[model samples]
Target: MSPFNNTTFTHAVFLLTGIPGKEDVYLWITIPFCLVYVISILGNSLILFVIKTDSSLHEPMFIFLSMLAVADLGLSIATIPTILGVFLFNSREIGVNGCFAQLFFIHFSQFTESSVLLFMAFDRLVAISNPLRYTSILTLPRIAIMGLVCVLRGFALILPLPLLLKRYRYCQDNVLSHSYCLHQEVMKLACADITVNNIYGLAISILTMGLDSLLIFISYVMILKTVLSIASREECLKALKTCGSHLCIVLLFYSPEISLSVTHRFMHSSSHLLQIILGYIYMLVPPLMNPIVYSVQSTHLRVRLIRLFVK
Candidate 1:
């Protein structure tokens, strides 16, 4: 009756491993994971709280930020349970449907974050390119619709994954490299042919993450061009200044991901621990760092935070 019973495909389970080569150090590993969870939750919660309570912070820029905060929180929530289970409780077994749900949520959040970053880039471009028209253009209704689109895009793109995975049976040891379930990771363990799953997975990555990253890069290029055209050097700095946090966030989100992808492709021969470390960086670092980046860059947020804590 165990989920890991080999006789039943429906009951198949994937064993979630926290870190491949560091099992003995799970107790110590839990410390960093705990820190990441608290920071991601509290930092993002503060962002939501500050933006929500202040009328002045209700612009498109901050509104998009709130959206990003929600996505970050969701990403953290998706991975935290299994991570804690592995590190604290030694719970590794995840049933078929549980794995599917985890995989879906993880990918969905990643895609949502990518889409939000792309939109945030557009937000910066519009704010800098034409400040006068920014407010009128990105109205509450428009922002709401955009947020909805982000949610739907994440769901629609990843909805097929569980179904695709279900059609195949997994007979391998069903051990995953990390504490979280990823679509590609689970698909690789399938005993059946996964050509369709592989193609679809790659296609979705290209269409979502790849396309979004490309457009974000283009948006920034245009933004930098406009910033450079300002007559006053101060004005140019001011223009670029608004994008400082966003620029850092874009790099924070994409660069590690790109590095990890390249490593997986060209450097598979490298250390497994290195890959796990990269994966940790890819998942946990952004949520950990985003709030710090924003608060450091924005005087308004920092002042507001100070006032909040002063009381």
Candidate 2:
């Protein structure tokens, strides 16, 4: 009823739940997350190294892959620290400002990662559809510009989020359900009306993520038609093989995100732990799996990774 009903508290306790085991359960979570973090860093670093050192990998696809690795690394680094802190220190208290900062970085990295994937899709479309001009089209300067554009797009998309949070009076519940402050979670705590925030958040998602997904889908559809028109089965197989890893990654990334959004909206508290686990999976699993996907499915990158490690 009151406009400032929940504005009394300056800070709130953020909850960190979902440890399956007993008191020492954090050890299990920490160990696995640490391993994943290490693997992600090493894997992505190797990709970056291979792309930098190997002149043969100086093509557009590898360039985009390297950027994707960097984005994944940033995503992992942004979220893992707080998660580890919650498990290690058994403390879930994050200041409102800190929460907002974490939320910003997480969303920023997420959007950047999505942008990179969209660019990768375009890169593939060019490689398959216009092989002759692929290099000219996706040259280093152009690639750099694409990367810059992706970053700027992410920043521009999420810039209003923190500002919107600034207008909110957090009186409902200061403690976020998950380890980090998610956008919806923070918005839910606001004492002020959240109609604008929700609308803006949905709009941003539709513009960036929804639009990106639609474009990727269209690109792949065009790619499929082109592949089908090819006369040779082997050539078609090879083309599909080239896109296999990317396809896998895209499915993995988007499916859970869509489900999480839906579940969080309707199911809400029914699957809080499930939501937290999915959040961790969405953030960490892609990074962990990306290297494997590239190494197993990509011959050039795999060889480069092997050689770099050997050296």
Candidate 3:
């Protein structure tokens, strides 16, 4: 019996792929993937716990960091099940509803993370450009609202994707290129024209991540201006030092992301394995590396971590 509902014009199930042509060493591949997942969860959870418990760490910068940690955790959780299932159990079948749910959470967390990074940039700018008013300008309530807005904006943008995708009929085998379902990957299998889906997907990417990237650039530029104008070299160095960790995180998150997006859209002739690898890096690297970067770069965070461990 056909798994797809012909009358409803929707697929009931989709097949997920593990590492292409590397099925024989699925166990070996699982080792690294599992390590990455475990490290991401523990590291991000520690960041959240430390931030929640430490009174001194409740400032705007750490608040934004906590939000980023939550987003990383969400992204990791959204993908880990399917990834582990594919590698550990060889379970590749995902129901249509499950696929859509995963799709929404993955993209929603991505969009929210991007938004958090943008706001963190603004936080840096305010700290360097107007240190005296930083606390006054970014009160706890205001930051909480900003966090809420990030989530709501992501939800509003990504909520329609599954609904839009449901209107099409997938006539071909519903085998996805990656271990998990993605909006673009799912839409590519549809028999009908996906112009609306393509346009909407592209539009949201441009407006959200694209625009956020530009604004982050602008914020740093202004921060640079502010730093350079400081009279004392010591003060200037201090200001730049404050932004160093955030700069590293920005590069970590967006560099591979932009690469993967470009490869997906323009490098159609590229190696399939390369594309899948990029997808894994894009989803996994930020979560895995974020806390490490912060721990090494932020003096306060580093000290707090040391104190937590030493005692």
Q: Highest lDDT: give the candidate number.
A: 3
Q: Name the weakest run of 10 consecutive residues (lDDT summed) in model 2.
A: 1-10
Measured over all alpha carbons after superposition, the RMSD of each candidate to the real structure, in angstroms, is 1.8, 2.7, 1.5
Candidate 1 TM-score over all chains jointly: 0.96
Pairwise TM-score winner, candidates 1 and 2: 1
Where model 2 places Cα greater than 4 Å from the true spot, the runs are 1-24
Worst 10 residues of 3 by lDDT: 2-11
Better of 1 and 3 by lDDT: 3
lDDT of 2 by residue, 1-311 (tens): 42234444344444544354444777776889888989989888888887898899988888888888988888888888787888888777777777778788888988998998999999899989998998888888989999999999999888889888877666664556676778988888777899998998988888888899999999999999999999999999999888999999898888888777777777866666787777777778888888789889999888877787797
In the range 1-311, model 1's lDDT, one tens digit per residue, is: 33444656676778887777677898998998898999999999999999999999988988888899999998899988688898999999888899899889888888999999999999999999989999898999999999999999999989999989888777776788878888878888888788898889889988999999999989999998998888999999888889999989999999888787677656869887777788889889888888889989989888988899999
**Backbone clashes in model 1, listed as residue pairs:** none
Tens digits of lDDT, candidate 3, 136-220:
9999999999999999999999999998987777776778999998998999988889999999999999999999999999999
TM-score, structure 3 vs. true: 0.96
> Model 2 has how many clashing residue pairs?
2
Cα miss at 155, model 3 (Å)? 0.3
Q: Candidate 3: which pairs clash?
A: none
